[model samples]
Target: MARMVFCRKFQQEMEGLDVPPMPGAKGQELFDSVSKQAWQEWLNHQTMLINEKHLNMMDLTARAYLNEQRDKFFAGDAIDSVEGYVPPSE
Candidate 1:
């Protein structure tokens, strides 16, 4: 059976990640509180932000912006949307 955690983002118990998503305290915090589904969603959103904004991952400012956005995302705060982008129809 998969591990369960009280997902901080969704505010309910959900399937947890098998391991930390990254190293250090932040990763451990996520492992303890973030659901796998939420993590995946964040990754998708992050990718869109990278592509649409043309952010350079190697740039410190770009990385910092992403980190801030990530925090806001998990906290349920309003985040910037990809300008001129639309979702696909079913």
Candidate 2:
């Protein structure tokens, strides 16, 4: 059976990641509290933010912004959106 966690983002018990997404305490925290579905959603949103804002991952400010956004995302707070971008019709 897959590991399960009480997802901070979704506020429900769900399937968890197989391993920590990164090293150290923060990664461990996420592994314990975040679900796989929420993590994947955040990754997709982060990628959209990077592409839409033309953010450079090598830049400290950009990384810091992403970190802030990530925290807000997991906390169920409002996050920055890609301005002037529209989703495709299904």
Candidate 3:
């Protein structure tokens, strides 16, 4: 599971971050530009589904959302801890 920090500003949202511009903002570094784009698209779909379900507890819901999406990526081996907030390791 993962979480979206409430502290994150609107412009800092990861909406376009899956594949950050080269030499620009780095995101999803594990995936190349093309791969990251595809992954982000898939992530959007999953996020839509999660939002549709409507969760009252955002933290728990976000974590589950990320984990669920991770399953679709690497057999669920992607361990992005959305349970806490931290700057991107990159």
Candidate 4:
């Protein structure tokens, strides 16, 4: 059976992850409160951030920046978008 959680990002009850995405208390919090869909959204946003900013994951500063963004994103706070990015018309 699938697990359920009250996804903080989406603000709705949804399917939960099988395990925390990372180590630490925050990871456990995400596993309990974030949904699979919201997590996938963050992955996409993180990818965009990485590409747009030319972020080098191996660099400590870059990793720290991403971590901050991840926390804000999951907390339903404002997150910066890629510079000069234009969303496609619907």
Tens-digit lDDT track for model 4 on 1-90? 899999999899999998899999979988999999999999999999999999999999999999999999988898998897788999
lDDT of candidate 2 over 1-90, digit per residue (tens): 999999999999999999999899999999999999999999999999999999999999999999999999999999999887899989
Residue pair clashes in candidate 2 = none
Worst 10 residues of 2 by lDDT: 80-89
Q: Relative to the true structure, how large is the alpha-carbon lDDT of every model?
A: 0.95, 0.96, 0.42, 0.93
Which portions of model 3 show Cα errors greater than 4 Å? 1-29, 32-34, 73-90
For each of the candidates, give the backbone clash count.
0, 0, 4, 0
Model 1 TM-score on a 0 to 1 scale: 0.97
Q: Identify the superior model by TM-score, candidate 1 or candidate 4.
A: 1
Q: Which regions in candidate 4 have their CA more than 4 angstroms from the true location?
A: 88-90
TM-score of each: 0.97, 0.97, 0.34, 0.89
Writing each residue's lDDT as its tens digit, candidate 1 over 36-89 gives: 999999999999999999999999999999999999999999998988789998
Worst 10 residues of 4 by lDDT: 78-87
